[model samples]
Target: MPADDGERGAAALAQMRAMTADICDVIPLTAEDDFRITTATMMIGNALLVDSRVTDLEYDRTPAHIARGGLDHFHVTLCIEGEMWFSSGRRDVMVRAGDICLLDMGPPNRTVLRGGGGRTHLRAIILQRAMLAPRLAHPDAATAILLPAQHPHARLLANHFAALMLPPAPEAGSAEVTIEAIADIAAAAAGGTADIAAGVERAERHLYLAVIKRRIADNLETDALTVDELCRHFQISRATLYRLFETDGGLAHYVREQRLNLAFRQLISPAARETRLIDMAVNMRFSSDSTFIRAFRRKFGLTPGELRELADRWLRETGAVPAIDTVLHQLARRRKS
Candidate 1:
């Protein structure tokens, strides 16, 4: 949840800039004499909502920010009581009160928020790229798509956000459902959804996929990680399981990839550096040490042993361990390119 910065003038402006420096660059366009910012934030998992009333400012996600590698997310902003100009790629948009706009954080973009008098009310939701990209037919096509308040879906979405933000906030148990509802409405409003029902189903698919992924990670050492067994355990049909992992190629491939990832983490972790490859293979459910080595080499272009040694040298020289997820995400992006 967002907390109050509890400062004013130059102090508040500096605080606001620092708050968002990691994700985007914020430039205060308001005068320093009376610069002001207030916000309440709510987040569940990777779904984040910021209800902000702030002074005029320019928010920029530049090429440098993209290269720094944390832009795998999306933003849907509702202009409750403000005027703004937004641009990304070839499109530009003017957003006013009762209007909504979409921003793909993965791309370089700029938005100027003009509060008319150095104060504006805007609600923005940030979501992971993995969560929203699957729902977009052409992810880049809808950037800066404005959904006016008159649009039926936009009106309904506004109501949902308003209700969730009202007194007596929603419970933690309902966070997944809340995120699902928001995603469905925003995707539909952006013209990326086929229908309301399909949008709802797509959102639900991600919710369930997250749960299943957690289970997979928790039970990585189990023999029941196979497709058939997982289907049985989750009480889902084979086709359902396949569809859930369609983007990942297939259920079997997803599991194998996860196992390999987990194995890599184990090999490079200082605590597990002494763990033998054969034991790690068995723990990761590989049939044999040789099988694990070959698969690992094929996927990462390095044998497990070689990768471990490199990780050690890198840590020794830099005094910092390699972050496997960041490396893997970068590697994945490179392959796609």
Candidate 2:
């Protein structure tokens, strides 16, 4: 349900607003019809995916009742940063942050997201039922109702998704990979085995690595950060550091890629419009502009000027931009799938 600009975009926004309004109303009323569950009393981020709306709904819970929708989308609610009780026809569950529940769209179901002085905030990702139907062919899909709050994969997906939604990007070049892995996890949640692997502890370690990688991105301009230095800063052992970057060709190679990505962003950002190439290279912690140019070309198959020109041309082509973004997002999702 993606649309073009002007009236189409406005109409889409209005539709999403109305859908969220109904969702909010259904969340707190005692599973009844006359409650007129009006007003979202919440915010629905990611509103651009108008065909798909993700909303936050919270209020005092009364008696539980079945909620129905005209739209054919399954609501996969991850108890992200909160507490909730969810029940399908055959399964009832209590969820915390890191936990997830899939509300079956085709069946009668009930859920009460707890919220009060002692209760925490509840958040969930709502997926269109049709968008989810393709993956539900597996018999195990229904059993794979909710991911636990402490499961490593669940935590990883939650943290990565939040970071992608946040301002600063992760420092690691493999962030795209991490994000893909998260999407894969989401897909798996929609269809994989119900029981999480026993290696949840190990997955937790990878989440730590993700946070560390973000820290590295933040310190990209600081030339003094070395393997030993980073180890000391993070209180991680040298062996652990090596393991964290093992999939990315170890610490040095990983760091180089981080620098390169930042350099690429800088080469095209407004900040670099007035800066000299040599100065920009140095500011990105590159040793020399010549080396930077060589590396950039080797990685991107284009010189800085060429790449900038390409980027500018892309900006001028409005129709192509959204297509590119969609392709990139799909590729990222496929990687995890």
Candidate 3:
């Protein structure tokens, strides 16, 4: 804390960001007059103990941040007073007072703190992955595991961090012992939570993606295949669905790619030689025939008509129908030539 009153908040913010540099990038979400933060950080070996209070702020962490920081530790945090909302790539968590949250610092995540104004107190013990990974049952699925306030293992761990946060710190030897005990209790509590919260979530995430994708592939003829419909049908938030296909650009992009691929296959089929272009567009969910032709040309280097004619010529010349994929491959080679 700075001796001058004017430097207090600014100094605190800078110090807090520097103290937790290994975790995430902290950005104050409130106005300067409304923003406030205070923190006490203690380091022992490769572990860190932090007690902090903030009015409101966002914790933004990404895979790139982890790579730059080079120390992605696991944080066992106890929300002593206030609330926290967290969303990692795969899980969303809401933590209330007395709840213990096990946050895997490895992945990309966003967290918002709410205390109604500087009343949110979070006491956390940060342990290096090397120190805790061996003890975890499912280390890969550990982020956003919220253990309720009354959970036995959670209560036990919470009580310890509470005592450690008080004045008159424990002796060096006692602190070392404390770290060992915290690690054991945390791994057990977190491992169990991960099994229920994260393990199933991991499998469920894959299942959800598969189900949503299959739905899109099968329903290209209807306008009901939009994101809004998918969300309502699956009873999932848009955020959850978007995260599922983030790497594929987005839900709309994935849908377009699937539609184009399906159209390509249908165009090459022997029975579809006489299919009308407008019908093909309507069946594939494009807004119009022109829209479908432009997109198909952009993606496959040939319009639907051009592709169909070429396929017909190839079949007539060879006296055999080429595989759908082989036709696409031939077009790609032609494009490069």
Per-prediction TM-score: 0.54, 0.49, 0.50
* Model 2: lowest-lDDT 10 consecutive positions: 46-55
What are the Cα lDDT values of the candidates? 0.76, 0.53, 0.75
Candidate 3 residue spans exceeding 4 A from truth: 1-23, 166-173, 192-337
Point out the higher-scoring one by lDDT: 2 or 3. Answer: 3
Model 1, range 128-241, lDDT digits (tens) per residue? 878877667677775887888777446545645665564432122255576766777667656654655466666556545655665676677898777788777666788888
**Best-matching candidate per TM-score:** 1
Sorted on TM-score, highest at the top, how do the candidates line up?
Answer: 1, 3, 2
List model 2 lDDT by residue over 122-241, tens digit each. Answer: 444445544444444453245326777666555555555455444555543354444333333555555633332233334445555776787678788886569788776666689978
Residue lDDT tens for model 3, 229-269: 98877777889999988977998998888889888888877
In candidate 2, the residue pairs with backbone N, CA or C atoms under 3 Å apart (3 or more residues apart, or in different chains) clash, namely 25-37, 73-128, 73-129, 74-129, 98-149, 171-217
By summed lDDT, which 10 consecutive residues of candidate 1 come out lowest? 166-175
Query: Per-candidate RMSD vs. true structure?
Result: 14.7, 10.6, 23.1
TM-score: model 2 vs. ground truth = 0.49
Model 3, residue 51: displacement in angstroms?
0.4
Clashing pairs in 3: 55-118
